[model samples]
Target: MEPKREFFPKVKKTVMPRPYFATEKDVLGHRGTAAAVDAAIYGSNWYLDKEQGLIEIYDAGAAISFFNLLPRKDKYEKEGLYLRLKIAYRTTENANVNLRNFSGNHVTLPNSLTGAMYDDPQTYWWVTDDLTLNINSIFSGEKLWIQRVDWEWMSKEIIYEDELFAKNTILYRSLEEVQKLYSEKELTDDDVKDFLRDKIKNDDWFAKKCLVMLREEQLMGEKLVKLFEDSGLEL
Candidate 1:
């Protein structure tokens, strides 16, 4: 006999809107003194080359501040937001830069000479806060040059399989089946607990199946697992 294949709901993804850019005018201030460098050499200082659109740093413990750059909290309270930096920089030695919000939540930028975009691994919780970019140079002569900064919302909707199932026709049938099972008796707290336990178990099973199907696509699968864990569903 042939084995029956499991069918799962089709996952839907709505692409997020384009990212918003922050211009040089948005820069508010700096923590350390900005000095001019006549030669290619640098010291324990920072330089803002407005003409070249770069914020150059030569040592640790220096920061560049920017105005609060995100929308109101209510705007993305449910979906969450992200901060990203578009930097074209080179370092004499290994360096790290921290992108921090007013609330002090931050993400680090590891050493990279090639120009590329870097996203904050943490979600932007405080949408209405100023931002800062702190530089950390590993060596005395290490240098860094920051080119640009931008931010955006999460790229896709975060929905769990159980949440989707709750809106499906199968959920209605399941509820009706439970109702029929208790038709003759008044539902009690114990009965409700039992029902919820069964429902959760069923939802967990469905989520696991969905995860298995998504496993090959690692990013999607990891996202699904995070959603499942957040929703209190077992893997």
Candidate 2:
């Protein structure tokens, strides 16, 4: 008798919708047992008020902390896996900190007391490696009270909206310059194609913009599409 083989495989992914908070004990207790800890000072500059649920930083120059994101290969492989940090408290006057990762990808936290999201263009973590995240204060006066850290997979609609905004910004700037140059003469189809060709050839970021223009059926959109297709450029 032959062994039975299943036609389909069942696979599920676990996602965390709410923010994950790490306490003082959690960090201090699991410091050496887990991955390597570069620097985590408790009393000198970094203080944790368990009562108020806040991690306070005072005049600490680049105070660092490590976080271990449990193995989640499926979640990491998905698109728009944005890392978010909930800033509970921050000084109103020039108080901010930089959230740096193991890969050196960092984003400046907003001065205001709000949640900061990391829009990293590069891959943050790998499937086989331990996901270690770090945080630091750049300036001496920069004080921050971090509440918790979390991550979420952004929806496709939100991603599309951001792309739309970028496309519109580029289109507006290009049109402003074109209008000034062709104020006296009527803008012809050839003029539009030439402008687009120059943008596509010179600007590296214009390829995305060209796709947006074609989707919106803007002027010379067809011609621009044809030009890219003829040149064997994948848009």
lDDT of each: 0.51, 0.48
Local error of candidate 2 at 144, Å? Answer: 0.9
- Mark the 10 consecutive residues where model 2 has the least summed lDDT: 28-37
Overlapping backbone residue pairs in candidate 1 total 0
- For every candidate in turn, the CA RMSD to the true structure comes to 23.4, 20.2
**lDDT tens digits, residue span 3-99, model 1:** 9998878968889988977453332221111222222222347777868767677756665554433333244343332333233345544666554
Off by over 4 Å in 1: 1-44, 68-75, 78-89, 96-108, 124-128, 159-235
Report the lDDT tens digits of candidate 2 across residue range 38-98: 2243335666766766666665443344444322324423343333222233543576667
Q: In model 2, which regions exceed 4 Å deviation? A: 1-44, 61-66, 69-89, 101-103, 113-136, 154-159, 162-235
Clash count for candidate 2 is: 0
User: Which prediction has the highest TM-score against the true structure?
Assistant: 1
lDDT of 2: 0.48
Clashing pairs in 2: none
